[model samples]
Target: MTEQKQETKCITLKGSAVLLKEYLLYGINSILYQRGIYPPETFEPAEQFGLCILMSTDPKIKNFFDNVLGQIQEWLIQRIVEKVTLVILNVNTKEVLEKWDFKVDYETVSSNGNADDNGDGKFIEVGSKDTKTIQKEIREVIRQITGTVSFLPLLDCLCSFDILTYTKPECDIPKDWDETDPVFIANSQEVKLRSFSTSIHKMDTIVSYRNT
Candidate 1:
């Protein structure tokens, strides 16, 4: 039996930027243009989006293009997004940013308006530490982000998206999926979390989780 060589293309930062451009602009611009706030002819989704990211990387390269192609991220969120996510998948460009970097990253600087959370604001604290509440809040965030991204035309432009979602009603995860979270063994082979939500998060081990 001979295995065929897989024609896999490298996942680079450029690919991520390309996807980001579409997901961040077209859907938002289309709605804004219909609202008559921004002129129809002036609303160049692809070009504007491409220029925004390009401007961030190299403002000098665009020369005078920077003046016409000002970055507009907050506008997109204000017009078309109830929620937003910055997904980075390595495909072409070499310099990938660190985790949680986008949490504070912004294209347009606000005029003495805010410095904390980069204007995203702190997540509201929901009372009750029950597992149901945790799951509900997480699911709500997921629902919002998914809804936002569904309008994006370039969702298929990704090699893969690695995710870790945990859900359980007494361990009510997807039952048929024959996948288990990674675990490690110590001297006590039969070790378990002493109680629900009582275990410490380890560097390289799955910790048991519960609402209580």
Candidate 2:
């Protein structure tokens, strides 16, 4: 009974992927709200990671995240996604202003779910960390994101946002996916935030803004 109870607490690759997707969902919404890309009234408060997160109520924005992050979850399980970026830019001039990057690193998982010498370098089916602890780490990252508004320069012009996902070169690009040049901010200043690991995948976040 003890072993069975402990087994239920194991974090699997799919579970980690789901958690990653949720973090992106909440993090992006928080960015949108904090940066004032959308009107503050368009978002509603919701509880996540023990924090009151403001999620977008706009149907279009909601659907966009659902579809994009849904696909990202699958790729994460496959260990193919490299990074996901949220780019904020001026709507009129189309100049890039700020970028938030979520970088992923794949970790080796043992076959028996134990980190033993006998296990070969493959994939982690069952991870080592518990869900509760991971959520706590996520809470801190989100808190830092909210605090960034204090230092990040104001967007004086009308602005909009877009999400970009970087994948391994051999990844199978979906027919609906279009290739685009990488977005960059000239004379950018970057700040790295705290990282969280699921024992299967490690995530690091960095935010860069044009030093105007």
Candidate 3:
């Protein structure tokens, strides 16, 4: 008897957009917990992407992430966002200590749309990829995120994090969004981590820390 091959299906643009947003949210939360940016007790371990992941349970933190990821999803669908950066800084000195850069690539989207454009312009047909395969890739990225603690410097001082999105120059900025300069680390060491793609979108992860 021959084994039957499972058929793969292409996800819709809307579905891909949601998946990408969730990935970013979870990835940020994972980094926050792993880097000891917040109290470990504030997060609870939960199963996701075939791995036990820690997620923030505090109401204020949850709400903030919701608002940020909501707007990010909007930009993602329109394919205007180029990169999402998580900047960790020393609260006292207001100096950047570490940076987690998630570079985004819209594999099947057009480049002609403005940031204010709401309509889906020149839709690219998404190719088929197995859901399990995507999950496996995500699991690997998560493992890398967790392992980064071994190399990253100890954040002995008080620290805070800021989320920044790099978008097209023509993209309209919301009232809540303000222009800010990129927070770069001095004498930094960078490490490139594993990346995963959902056929329609690809995200590459990089971490830069202040070399002590």
Candidate 4:
């Protein structure tokens, strides 16, 4: 009889608190989906959507981002939930709270590598973070982690403290949701604006999830 050895699972993102702080904000503004919208097979360059990201100097906002990012990373690599590509940030409290303008496109679209002109080559307000650089960086990061596994398309959406996730035709189950305990969030949509911390660090993990 041959004895079998069990392989230990690696915690790549947990040890480092801000798992994706160093990453470029490409996926933040893009969504992904398979070519046929089915499963297992997708097209090249992938189907994409727009998204945004924002943060404030508020302690609660800081805590929220940390918790959300950490949980998502745990699911992405550990649980292999592949969905979402781009994200957008909305630091302007008034705009988000009062107006609730969550749309991703400002004017037009373009095919050029520049996501800033956004494939339109036209002048626009609030452009993306330059797709040329961010896309390459994203692919490199994914390759490092996923190796050669296929991932679903993600349509980047407005990044807020609210419950945002990547999904498919079915809204019930997110395309890349974690299989862990239910995450109870209270007053998640409400947020306070602030500046980026000195640096993304481990000391910034969120302990409380619900209304605290």
Candidate 5:
């Protein structure tokens, strides 16, 4: 019998960005459901990253994420985005209640000639790691976010969430998007969640809340 060879998985920049965007999409949905930003009945059960996740069914909310994450994916491909934050605030007082920061780091690509090299002597960043491993890591991060309800302070007031994308200074800002000051939680308690990497890009997540 002939020996079987394992097929190599090649991860390009565009593929990496798509994976990151998917994580953000499901991750934000999980947060909204767990934090009670909307009525529990408004969300429906969905499966992602091998976990049953609750996703928002509200049309406005769904539209919001689609637009925001779309721009973010482009930035991720250009390696211009720094962090994407989901800020939870009191609708009445505009007080920041919680902040979830998804920080991005571009992995260094080796210059040594390999399969990733183009004919022009320039190397394209490529990830050889299997997608299954990356998805497993994402699963753990989502699980941690779900577990945060245990220790996080109850958001008793009406709360709203805004997504902020931090990009490099050289990055061009879209006309529809305005520059806003970063939100911070006063006297905060922070918990860093497990991070996942696609070999081309590494992501770290941290959640902060007001200390009471």
Candidate 6:
């Protein structure tokens, strides 16, 4: 009998960015679906990161996230972004109801010089972490997002959502991206979710809702 060997899957800086982007995009969709932000029919289940994730299917919404996450991935590679937030607001009153924040820590990669932008303006691979571990962490985060409805107050009004990115003050802003103030909920209750690190980047998640 021949012995079987197991192969280790490694994560790179670029890979970490990709993973984080997917987490943001899919994670938001999961929240929206679980929280009734949109019609349940607007989303469909898709397997990702070894989990059955709900993905937005509306073309307009899908295109919007593509542009948003694409720019985020670029910034992630440059290590200039500090955090990304998802703000859900009441349509009529224009009041913030919920906020989902994903905080990024680049210190690990920065200390190793892996976050520096190459002359070619691309992320260079520096180190790797086991892919299975990363996915396990992501799965837990998604699970938490789905479970949030148990405690979050019912959103009684029509709601809309916006994406906000926090970056270095001196970072060049793209023409398509606009500057905005942070949207916060009043008398908010916050729940910290599971965090995942790819050795190059670490992401911490928190969800805040209006305590009404």
* TM-score-better candidate, 1 vs 3: 3
- Output the better candidate (5/6) by TM-score: 5
Off by over 4 Å in 3: 1-7, 109-124
RMSD of 5: 3.0
The TM-score between candidate 4 and the true structure equals 0.25
Which segments of candidate 1 are over 4 A away from where they belong? Answer: 1-9, 41-212
- CA lDDT, candidate 1, residue 116: 33
Q: Candidate order by lDDT, highest to lowest?
A: 2, 5, 6, 3, 4, 1
lDDT of 1 by residue, 1-212 (tens): 12221112221222223333343233223322332322345544344322221112223423322221122222222222122222223344322111110111213221222233435763321111333332233333323332432332232222211122222223332343344442222221111111111011001111111111
Best by lDDT: 2
Clashes per candidate (backbone, < 3 Å): 10, 0, 0, 34, 0, 0
- Which is the winner by TM-score between candidate 1 and candidate 6? 6
Local accuracy by lDDT, each model:
0.25, 0.91, 0.83, 0.28, 0.89, 0.84
lDDT of 6 by residue, 1-212 (tens): 12221124335677788989988988999988988889999889999978898888999899999999999999998889999999999899998889999999984643333344556644556545677788889999899888888888999889999999999877888898889987877799998988888888899999998777
> Which residue pairs in model 6 clash with each other?
none
Model 4 global lDDT (CA atoms, 0 to 1): 0.28
Which of the predicted structures, 2 or 4, would earn the higher lDDT when compared with the native?
A: 2
Question: How high is the lDDT of residue 193 in model 3?
Answer: 98
- Candidate 3, after superposition: displacement of residue 161 in Å? 0.6
How would you encode candidate 4's per-residue C-alpha lDDT over 1-212 as one tens digit per residue? 12221112111222222223333122221111211112223222332212222223345644655665555555432323323222222345312211111111112222223233246654222222333333344344333223211332231333242334343232345455453322333443322111111121111111121122
In candidate 6 the C-alpha lDDT for residue 25 amounts to 89
- lDDT by residue (1-212, candidate 3, tens digit) is 12233235545556667877877878889999998889999999888888888999989889988998899888877789899999999999999999999999877543223232245555444545666787788889989999988888899999999899999887899998889987788899999999888877798999999999
What's model 6's lDDT at 162?
Answer: 91
Query: Which residue pairs collide in model 2, if any?
Result: none
Write candidate 2's Cα lDDT for 35-152 as tens digits: 9999999999999999999999999999999889999999998889999999999998999999999999998765554553346755447877889889989999999999999999
Alpha-carbon lDDT of model 6? 0.84
